[model samples]
Target: MKKLYFVHLLNDYSGSPRVLNQTITALRQQGNDCTLFVGSSGHGVLDELDVATHTFTYKRFDNRWLTLLAYVWSQVALFFALVWRVRPEAVVLVNTMLPFGAALAARLRGAKVVYHVHETSIRPAALKSFLRRVIACCASKVIYVSKYLQVQEGIAGVPAVTVYNGLSEAFQRQAMATAYQPVRKGRFNVLMLASLKAYKGVNEFVALAAALAEDPLLKFTLVLNASQREVDEYFASRSVPCNLEIYPASSNVASFYGDASLVLNLSHVDGWIETFGLTILEAMSFGIPTIVPPVGGPIELVCDGVEGYQIDALNHELLVRTVVRLSKDSQLCQALSERARAKASEFSTANFQKKIVMVFDEL
Candidate 1:
C-alpha cells in the first residue's frame, strides 16, 4: 500500500478540515497508510481519526511580513522532517499560497505532489496569475472541489479532477430521520445558517424577512458564527419584518435543521458554485426544502421547483413572493422535500468513498 501524507496549516472545523478528516478516515478504512501533518490546533478532530497525526509548533502571525516569513520557514522545516522520518510516496498540500512550497519541496524529494484548491489565492493581479500558471504546470495533480471553480481558473488540458465534498454516513442517517417527522403546528420557519459576512448574503436574507413581515405565516432564525460585537452591529443597522432571532454557532445544528421548514442560501460571489452546498444538503437530508439564488453550487443540488425553487435575484419583493407561494402550497412543499432527500442521497459517504478510493488507486 502506498503511504500518503496530508498537510494543512490549521485544524479548525470548517469545510476544508472536515473534508480532510473524511478523506483520511476513508483512506485508512481501505488499508492505506495515511498521515496528517497539522499545526497547533490539531488535537480536536484529528485525534479521533484512525490515521496518525504529527503536530508542529508553527505559530500563526497576523503581521503580513512576519506571517509570510514564518510560513516559509515552517514549510521548509516540515518538508525535511517528513523526508527524514515518514518518507511518504505522495504529499497532498491542502491549502497554501505562493510557489506552493510544500509541493515544491515534495517534488525535490522525488515524491508526487497533489494540490487541493479550496479557495482563490490572494495576491496582486500579476503575481496571482503567475502563481496559477506555475501551480498548473508543476504539480503532479490538481483536484478542484467544484466545476464552477475549474471554469473560473480556466484550467484546461491539465492533470485536473473534480472531487466533491461528502457528508458522513451519520449525518445522512440524521437527515433521513429528520425528513420522516410529522409536521408540527407553527408558522413556517425559515433558516439561514451562514457566517454573517458581507458576501454570504445575510443582508439579503434579512431584507427578504423584512418584506415578508406583515404575513402572519412566516418566521426566521439567523444563525451566525461571529463575535457578539459584530452580531450586535449587524442587527442594529437592519430592520427585519418577521419574528427574528440571532443565534450563535451551536453544536446542535441538526436540531435546528429538524425544526426548520426551509433552508436559504444566497451567496453573491462563490469560488466554485460551492463544490457542495453542505448546509443545503444537510437541510434536504432532513426533508426540508431549500431556496437559493440561481448561481453556484445550489443550482447543482436543488432542482428548481422540484427539490427547491431558485430566486431570480436577491430582490426583497421577489423573495417575499416566492416564500408566500411555497408557504401556501402544501403539496408543493411535500414534493420538494421528497426530491431534496433523493438528491442528497447521491452524495452519500458510500458513493463518495468509492470514488475517492478510485482516485487513490489511479495515482
Candidate 2:
C-alpha cells in the first residue's frame, strides 16, 4: 500500500468529516501510512478518532471574499511548510472548494491527488463551476459520494468514481440487534434526526408538526445539534405545535430509533439537494423505515412503499396520508422495516473499504 497525506476542509461532525475519519482508519489498517491535515476544528468529530492529524492556519471568515483569500494564502504557506515536509506519494483533498490550494500543492510536488468531492452547491453556480474545472484539471482521481452529486458537479473529462457512503460497524450492529416488536394501539413517537439548518428542512419539520397537530395520536421529536432551551425559545417565537419536541443531536441515537415508530429525512430540493442522506441510512440501519423526500440522494436509498415512503415536498396530502397509515398500521411498518434492514447490506463498511482501496490502487 502506498503512503498518502490528506487535506481536509473542516473539523465539523458532518457526513464529509465522518467519511474522512473512516477513510484514514481503513487506510492505516491496510498498512498504508496516512496523515490528515485540517484548516481548523470546531465540532470535535476528528478529535477522538485514532489518526495522524496536523493543523494549518486557514481559518474560515464571515466574509466570503476574506475566506477565499485566507484559504489561498494558507495553501501557499502550507504547500512548502507542511505538505512538502510530509512528502507523501499522494495528497487527498477532502472536498472540492478547498482543492484550490491542496491541488496546486500536490501538483508542484509531483504527488498524485485524489479530490474527494462531497459538496452539491446549487447557489453561486459560477464558483461551483470554477472549482469543478480546477479540480478536474489537478486531480488524478475524483471520488464522489453519490452519482447524483457527480452529475451535479459536471466535472466532465476527469477520472472519477462514485462511492456511496456506508454505515459504521456500530450502526450496522444496531440494525442487526433490532427485533420487530408489536406497538401498542396508542400514540406513536416519530423522529426526525437532522441539523437545525434551513437546507435540512427543520422549518418544514416544524410546519409538518403543526399541520399534524390535530392528529393527537402522533408525537414528533426533532433530534438536532442545539440546546433544549434555544430550541424552546425558537419554538416559542414560532407557531410550534404542542405535539413537537426538539432535542440536541447525540452520537448515540439508537435510543431515539428505539423510541421512534417512523423516521424522517424531508429535505426540500429548492433549499438543499442532499448529496446523501446519512440520517436516513442510519435510521434504516436500525430497521426503522424512513419517510424521505423525492429530491436527491435519499430517493436512491429507499424503494417507495417497500423500504420507505418518498413523498414530494409539495404533496402535503400524500405526506400526511403516509404518516397516518404508518402510525395506524404496525404490520406495514414492520414489513418496511425488515426490507430496510435488508437493503442496508448494499452499503456496508467492508464493501465501502474495498471500493475505496480499489480506487486508491487504480490511482
Candidate 3:
C-alpha cells in the first residue's frame, strides 16, 4: 500500500469532511498508511475519527478574505515542513482553494497530488483561472463527487473521475434505528434542511412559509446549522408564521428526519448548487419524501413524481401546490417515502468505497 496524506479545508462535519473521513477509513482498511492535515479548527467533530490529524491555527469561514489569506500564508512553511518529513506517495486535496497552499508544498516534495473537487462554482474569474492551472499542471489526478459537478466546472482534458459521496455507516445504523415508515396524521411536517446561507434559498423558504401560513394542516421547520446569532440576524426582519419553527443544527438530526413528512432542498442557482446533496439522501434513507429545485446534483438523486418532487424554485406556485398535495394525500406520501428509501440505498457507503478504491488504483 502506498503512503497517503489527506488535506481538507476544514475539520468540521460538513460534506467535504464527511467524505474525507470516510475516504480515510476506506484507505486504512486496505492497509495504507495515512495522515490528515486540516486547514482550520474543526467543530470538535474530527475527534470521532481514528485518523492522525494536524490542524492549522486559523479563521472562521467568513466574508473577510484577508483572514483566510493570512492563515494560508502563515501555514505555508509549516505545511512544507510536514510534507518534507512525511514524504507521502500521494497527497489528496479536498475541496476549494482552501488546501491549494498544502498541495503546492506536496508537489514541491515530488509527491503525486490528487485534487477532489466538491465545488462547481468559482468566483472572481482569477480564482477560476488559478483552479484551471492547478487541475491541469499540479494535480496528477482529479476526483469529482458527481458528473453534474464535473460538467458544471466545464474543465476539459484533465484526468478526472466521478464518485458519488456516500452516506456513512454510522448514519446507516441510525437509519435502521427508525424503520422506513411515514404517518401522515396531525400537522403535516415540511422541513427545509440546510445551513443559513443566502444561496440555500433561506429567504425563499420563509416566503414559502408565509404564503402557506393559513394552511393550519401544515407546519414548516428550518433545520439549520448556524449560530443562533447568525440565524436571528438572517430571519429577524421576516415574519415567521405560528406553524413555522427554526431548529438549530445538531448531531441528533436523525430524530428530526424521523419526525419529518417531507424535506426540501432549495439551494439557489446563483451560488453553489448541490454538488451531490448529501443531506438529500440522508432524508431519503429515513423514507422522508423531499422537494428539491430542478438543478444541480440533486437532479441526479431525485426522480420527480417517483421518489420525490423536483420543482423550479422561481415558480413558487408549484412548490406550494406540491406540498399541499403531499400533505392531504396519505397514500401519496407513503408511496413516495417507500420509494425514496430504496433510491437512497443505491448510494450507500459500500458503493462509494468501491468507486473511491478504483480511483486510488488508477492513481
Judged by lDDT, which candidate is best? 3
Clashing pairs in 3: none
Ranking by TM-score: 3, 2, 1
Give me the runs in candidate 2 sitting further than 4 Å from their true place.
Answer: 58-81, 86-88, 96-99, 180-186, 226-236
- Per-model CA lDDT versus the true structure: 0.70, 0.75, 0.76
> Which portions of model 3 miss their true places by more than 4 Å?
71-78, 86-88, 180-185
Report the C-alpha displacement of residue 307, candidate 2, in angstroms: 0.8
Rank by lDDT, highest first. 3, 2, 1
TM-score versus the correct structure, for each prediction: 0.83, 0.89, 0.92
Estimate candidate 3's RMSD in Å. Answer: 2.3
Most TM-score-accurate candidate: 3
281-360: candidate 3 lDDT, tens digit per residue: 89998888988878788889899898898887667888889888888888888899888888988988999889888878
Q: Candidate 2's residue-wise lDDT over 236-265, tens digit each?
A: 767768999878746667777777778888
- lDDT (C-alpha) at residue 204 in model 1: 80
Candidate 1 Cα outliers beyond 4 Å, as residue runs: 39-50, 55-88, 93-99, 121-131, 180-185, 227-242, 269-273
- How accurate locally is residue 70 in candidate 3, as Cα lDDT from 0 to 100? 58
RMSD of each: 3.6, 2.8, 2.3
